[model samples]
Target: MRVARTHHRCARRSVVVGKPKAEPRASWVDEETFDAKKKRASLILRRLEKQYPDTRTALNYTTPFELLVATVLSAQSTDKMVNIITEKLFQKYRSPEDYLKAKPGELEQDIKASGFFNQKAKSIRGLSQKLVEDFGGEVPGTMEELLTLPGVARKTANVVLGNAFGKNFGIAVDTHVHRLSWRFGFSDHDDPNKVEQDLMKLFSRAKWFKVSHLLIDHGRNVCFARNPNCADCVVNELCPAARVPAVRKRAKPSPSA
Candidate 1:
C-alpha cells in the first residue's frame, strides 16, 4: 500500500511539472507576404491609436536642447526618473554652453542620482562641446548630424528627430519598442537597429514617428515584461505572444481612418 501511494504521488508531480500554461510565439516575420504584413501592422497601430491617442515621449522638456539632454539622461533610467532629474537639470543648464560651463565634476554630481553619472557626465559634456562648436549651440535636426554627437546612437537620434524636430528618419527602438516589435512579429532581430529596419518596412515613412510611440504606450500599459495582461490587450487576437489561444487566422484588416 505504501509503494502504491508513493507511485501515485510521483505520477501527479510529473504531470504538474511537465506542463506549462502556454508559450508566446513570434512566427509571422517570414510567413506573411509583405502586403499582408503591412495590413496587419496597420490594424495593430489603429487599435493602439484608439486607446493611446496622445502618443508621445514621456520625458519632460521645453526645448530641443532640453529634449536632447533629457533623452541622454534617459539611458539606463526610467522616464519618470529622467524627468525628476531633468526638472532641476533643465533649469540649471539651459543650453549646450551651460553644460560645458559646469565646473569640473559638477555635472557628474548634478546627475549622480540618474546612475552611471560619470559616463553620463562625460557624454553630456562631450556632446555639449560638439553642439556649441559644431552646431552653433542648437541640437542638430538631421539624422546624420545627430549621430555624430557623443553618446548618441540611432535610438537617441530618432527620439530627438521625431519628438524634438518633427522628423521621422527612423523609429526609436527602446526596450519597450524592442519587446513589442518581436511580439507583433514585426522583426525577428534582437538588434534594435535591425528591428527598426523591419518595422520601417511595414509602415509608411510618415507613420514611422507615431509607430514607435504607439508600441511604447501599449507596452507600458498592457504588454508588461512579466505577467502581461494578454486578455485585456487591444490586439491580443493578432499577437502570437499572447498567452491565450489566438484566433489562428488573419482577419480582414480595417483601413486606416
Candidate 2:
C-alpha cells in the first residue's frame, strides 16, 4: 500500500511539473497590411507627379517681391482673386517705397476684391516697412528672416523660400496639402506645421518642391473637399478609407408637416 501511494504521488508530480507543449507564436501583422500602405503611398506620388509635372504657383508674378506680396494677399482669398487685384496694384505700387508713400485707404481700395482688404493692406504695408528697414527692401531668402516679417508664417515662408529662392526648408502645408495628407493616412494632426513634419519624415527633401503642387492639383481635380471621387481615383485600391461617392437616383422632397 505504501509503495502504491508513492507511485501515485510520483505520477501526480510528473503531471504538475511537466512543461506544456509549445504553441507557435502568431504574427501580429501579415503581408497584407504592409503591402497596402506601401502601394498606396506609391500610387499617390506617381499619379500626382504625372498629372501636374509643371504644377507650380498660380500667382502671376515676375519678381520675388511680387511673389512675396501675392502670397501675403492670398491669406483668405483664392489665387484667382489675388491675381485680379494685383494686376493693377503691382503697376501702381512698383516698389516698397511706393507702398510706403501710398495712402492706406488707397491701397485698401486697390486690393478690395480679395476680401479683408483693410487687414491685408495693413499687413502688406507693415511687411514692406520691415523689408526696407531690415532687409534693404528685398525679400529675405532664409526661413528665419522671412518669419520676422508681418503676415509671414511658416507656410508663407516655405512658399517664398522654396518657389522664389529654390530652397527646401519645409513643405508648404496649405489647406489643400493638409487635407490631402490626412485623407491619404499620411498624418492625423490638425496643425499644418505638424503635418509638414510628418510628411518630411516620409518623403525625401528632393521631393518637397513638387509635393505641394501635386497635392494641390489632386485636391482640385480628384479629391475634392466635399465630394471625393474615390472610385475613379488611381490610388483607390490601396486607400482603406476610399469612399465612393454614392449616386442619387432622385431628389428627396421637402417635408411638409
Candidate 3:
C-alpha cells in the first residue's frame, strides 16, 4: 500500500483550473522552427526518461473503475489525499451498483478530504449510474464512450485510456503536465487540449502514454509551479524557462541626475 506521506503532491498542492481552461502561452517558449522544438522535446524526454524511469500514476487502483473514481476525486486535490480517501472508499464500494446505492450527499462526506467533495461526489455517482445503465457496469474503454460519463473530460479520458486500458489515445494534462509542458517548451498554449495537440506532434504515438507520467514526475520533484528547482532539473539545459537569464540592459539615468 502506498502511504499518503509518500506522495509529493500532498507535500505541495495547487487548485485545478476549470476545464476548457485558457492559459496564455509562456513568453519564455518563444517561437521556434518546428524541427528545433521537436528535437528539444526529444532530448528532454530522453534525459527525463532516465531520471524518472519508474514513473506512473501515483493514484492507487486495481481496476479501470477505481482509476476513474480516483481521477475524478483528484481534481483540485492531491493524489495522496485521493489515495487516502480511496483506501477505504474502494473497499466500501467495489462496483458501479454499489456507488449508485449511496444516498445523496453521503459520498460527499466520505470524500470531503479531497476537496470539492460536493461536485466530485455528484460526478462519481452520476458516472457510476451511467456505467450501470449504459455500459453494463463496466468502465467504457474508448475516448468517446468514456467522455459520456459525467466527470470524464479529455484529460480524464486520456488517463483512463492510457494507464487503465493501456491505449495511447492521448496525453493526460493535469496541473503538473500543464505547468511542465510550458516550462519544457513542449507547448506554448496553456489550454490543455491544445497543449496535448502540441505535444502529440512532438513525440511518436508509442511514447504518448509515457509523456505525461514522465513530466508529472519531474514537476513534483523538480519543476514546481512556484520557485522551481531549476538548478537540479535533469533537462534544465534544454528547458527555455530554466535557461540562464539574459543580461538586462542598464537603465538610462534621468537627466536631473
Candidate 4:
C-alpha cells in the first residue's frame, strides 16, 4: 500500500504565527476544560488525517485469528519483525486447532524471534485452545470474551475489536498511542488504560479505531520518543510536547576575506 507523503498544507497549520512563538504549556493543557480538549483533539485528528491518510495497523493478516496471533507476537517487538515472522508462521498454522496441535517447544521456536517467545508461545497456544473449546474455534468479537483469552488485555482486545470485528469499543493504547496521548495533552497519566479513557472522552466513539492508527503513524514517523521531529509534525501546534524548540544549526564562521 502507498503511504501518503507529508502534505505541506497540513504543516502550515503546525507553525506558530508570531515571532518568538510561545512554547506549548503543559500546565495550560492540564487546566483545559473538556470542551477545549475536545476541540483541540478534533483539530489534531484532522491534521493527522491529512498527513497520514493511509494509517493502519502495520501487522500483516488475512483473518481475524491471524491478526490476533500477530498482535500477540507484536508485544515488545516491532510490527516489521512480527510481520516477517508471521509471513512464514501464518503459512503453517492457519487455524486455532493448528496452533493447539503444535508441540509447545516447536511453537515456541517458531515465534522465538518475536522476543519473550516462551510466554508468547504459551499465550498463543492457550488462547487458541480456549477459542476452540469455548468460542467454537473463532476469535471472540466482544471485549469481555476476548479478554478471557490468555495474554489478552484491553490493548489487544481493543485492537481485535476495532480492526478485526469492526467494533469501536475503545482506543487501543499501545506504546505509540500511549506516548502520543501524553504528548497531545489528551491524558496526564502514564497508565495505558487511563490514557485510553482520556482519549475516549476527548474523541467520539466513531473515531476510536482511526484515532489509534493515526497516532501510531504519527508517532512512528514524526513524534518519536526521543528528539521528536516537532517542526515536521502535522499537529505540532496542537501538541503539548511540541513546546520544545526544534534542533538549531549553527552557521559556519565566514571564511576570512
lDDT of 1: 0.78
Per-residue lDDT over 206-256 for candidate 4, one digit per residue giving the tens place of the 0 to 100 score: 999999989887877888666778876667667767845555568999999
Residue 172 in model 4: lDDT: 88
Q: Write the per-residue lDDT of candidate 1 for residues 114-221, one digit (tens) a residue.
A: 788999899999999999899988888899998999999998899889987789899988777777777777776767788889899999999999998888788777
lDDT of 4 at 162: 84
* lDDT, residue 54, model 2: 71
lDDT per residue as tens, model 3, 184-213: 767657578998898899999999999988
1 versus 2: better lDDT goes to: 1
TM-score for each predicted model, relative to the true structure: 0.84, 0.79, 0.85, 0.84
- Arranged by lDDT with the best first, the candidates are 3, 4, 1, 2
Rate residue 219 of model 1 by lDDT: 75
Q: What does the lDDT come to for candidate 2? A: 0.71
Backbone clashes for every candidate come to 0, 0, 0, 0
Alpha carbon lDDT of residue 6, candidate 2? Answer: 8
Total clashing pairs in model 3: 0
| Candidate number achieving the greatest lDDT relative to the actual structure | 3
User: Can you tell me which runs of candidate 1 are displaced by over 4 Å?
Assistant: 1-23, 26-30, 245-257
Q: Largest TM-score belongs to which candidate?
A: 3
